[model samples]
Target: MNHALQLPRLEKTIPLSVVPSRLAAANAAVARFLIQAGAVREGDIPQAWDDALQVCERALDAWVKRELGALHCFRPYFSLAAVDEAGGYPSASCKEPVRYHKVDICWGECREQQWAVGDALEALERQQAGCGAAVLDVLREKSRFVYPLFTPDLACDVVSYVYWCGEENEEVALDMECGDNEDEREAMREEMVTRKKLDESFPAWVIATPRKRRLSRRALARLAQDASDPLARDIAADVLALATLRIEDEFRPDVDGEYIGFGAVLSWREDDLTVRIYDDLLQMAHQSEFCDRMGELEIAIDAPQAMRGWQSAMRVRFKTIRLLDRLIDRLSAGN
Candidate 1:
């Protein structure tokens, strides 16, 4: 996969110091990056959000391109750091002709495409130097625009991303606000389509657990419903309570624009109990925002470690599959 891009001569030039928290570090770093970029006055910050944002918008122009690159999603992210050296950073700019240097700073994932990357790296750098307020700034913007309830800042591994959402300190709600019944249905259908594509790519497996290999006719109907798409999530949950196996998976299917949609493949595992868990999906867990394909499987949490191991294996397999597919496709196309 192509790596994320960078502009020449961009460097961070700030002295290291202790700060109260991540927020303070971010505030300070934004001040420094802005001052070097010749974007704002140092005194403008440590104030209300609006005044501080003016300084941010100016500097954001110089680095905004890095935020939109789609590659950051499929490939692992590396550091896009500011340069530092023994005893001192390259140069300090108390004035114009702002100093430049090179360094590496790793950033977290952002939906695998069109990352809202501006906040995390900024927060990280500033926190190391003693400020992370800009993290909050970017977060406020996200809460206003995207998933409102979930902070979307907390970084997690593939498994964690599916099980949980939100950042430090309590739950944040994602505002997938439903306007009316029609909108909700459409959203559900969209998610279902995404899940279907995911199953095609990763392909959910049905494991035979250590249970009686028999299920009710209702059980069969439920799996068929979840396996396809839920007509009602509530019913899905109720049916899930009867499941024995577990299903673990996620699909990064998304739309880039009005006419542009793309999908990121998924992989997951459930030990010795695929049929029981698959039965859960047949019911309705797919309807809720937090639960999908395997929501019912989780209710059988008398078995998390086995599920986790299976999920991990699945992730490895999916990643390998994606890489191999890309390589084969490239070789065939001779690109």
Candidate 2:
């Protein structure tokens, strides 16, 4: 007999029996918020809300399958549920129905619950009535479930490249200046040759330099063309493409002249891990400190800023590359 089967079974804190009602309540809250905010007309609230809910649910399902594939036993039971006063403590104001909840591992004995949804009613009631930040935050969080900034495979490739570059040439400094004049260019050719020597040894030396510099799309394109190794060239090309899409699609500046980005927190409890993704750029900047402890690679993108013409001030922190690689490896192994 398998000893694992003999062990006490872990039951879900929030059972699946209450999931439908919770989801309905949460969706209703979201619908009401949208209608009140004029995002959707009161007449079109039902269809619009249902469509949005379906989109979020589908994205959540895909994210769970991709990220938690190794935990096969928990995959089927994990679901998006709303937190009520009974199942879990509701938000501060109990006068209204709860508008906050997140994806729960419904089959396990996990106690920790993440805040995946925002309190729409509270935002309207307490804060500025027109402030739709909470609604946008919820949508952004769900969207990130489907579209992570860096996928596990891409992150691993980047880490490998950075490691290879660092290992190949420890003596070569990456502080060379580019010259605009022809004479200056000729003078720097020897330095360029030295840099090329470093690149020749390890072609994947595009990012993670000691000095901070914004990576312009033009620079990335140039690097892609100059890369000697096919793999390095492809990686540089991929980065350039991703950077372009990210700036164009996601990293738009808000009315406050600040760019918005998603932040994620990974917590491990025994063999199970939970990932909480939120739309808090300030928190992301605060979390950059983790890069020092947990090996990190920062990529600066020259994105557009409100009022400002253009700024290469966007920084993305990939601190969980190793952990993500382990998860990916376990998933690949059919665990």
Candidate 3:
């Protein structure tokens, strides 16, 4: 007699449940197993995960559109003055003095839930298969459903997809834009020049940022160990997996002296450590010890008091802050 609990495969044709997300489908399978085993009851999936998924879906929908595909919106840093002069300012609060964009991509949040889902899936799969248990044999076929989601390959794939999406969007935006008059045409030409410069600046900002000076493998190891929250520690590993980065500085030609933009470009690294997730940038970014040190470096890139002249150095500093902010925000959210 077969005693193992048989579970239903995810339905692939229903309108509401047909296209289950990778994380969601994996999580739902695990959640069902736990319920069957009396490990946990229904209504346990936190509302926060629901909220984060909603936001991620919206961003995905925006990027999927042909017209919007060329517009890079992931943690974008742009000069408010320049946008306003071009009649593209989305809001007044999105104005100057904010060097880094204050938007949330929900990456950390979604990732945390996915990791939790992965842990649950692994545990449940082990139990169901009777691995390390007294049972001699069982169906091993179901084990493959517990795929490793947190590996470097998956991480790099997702990040690359995001970058490609941005590039596609930017290309479409540039090609579709047209000027109505000579003055408008001149403005368009200048904007195009500025955009191109910003594009070139991304890679330099990633490699040359002052944050690279303070970062070390050993330091990340210690920070991960010392972090109070488990999620914070896991996020540390996520940031470390990022192999490359790019930042661009944005300025306002109309305002003459306004420095109001920055951007992020990222890819995966394939070194020895890339195969093994280890480094932690969030804890280091949040450390008070490095804050003043990085602050001093920031002054060198900026004009000491004013917010203009955000060179490559400044772009690096701001991106670090943005990553730190993202981690902190994710850690603070309800589970």
Q: Specify the highest-lDDT model's number.
A: 2
TM-score of each: 0.17, 0.24, 0.19
The digit string of per-residue lDDT tens for model 1 on 151-235 reads 1122111112232232221112122334346666566545432223323322111111121133343544454365333322222
Q: Give the lDDT ranking, best first.
A: 2, 1, 3
Better of 1 and 2 by TM-score: 2
* Deviation from native of the Cα of residue 132 in model 2, angstroms: 41
Clashes of 2: 0
Model 3, residue 252: what's the lDDT? 14
Candidate 3: regions farther than 4 A off: 1-61, 64-215, 225-228, 238-255, 260-326, 331-335
For candidate 2, list the clashing residue pairs, or say none: none
lDDT of 2 by residue, 98-121 (tens): 454322222111222222111322
Residue 1 C-alpha lDDT in model 3: 88
lDDT of each candidate versus the true structure: 0.29, 0.31, 0.29
| RMSD per model, one decimal | 23.3, 20.6, 27.4
- TM-score, cand. 2: 0.24
User: Hey, what RMSD does candidate 2 come out at?
Assistant: 20.6
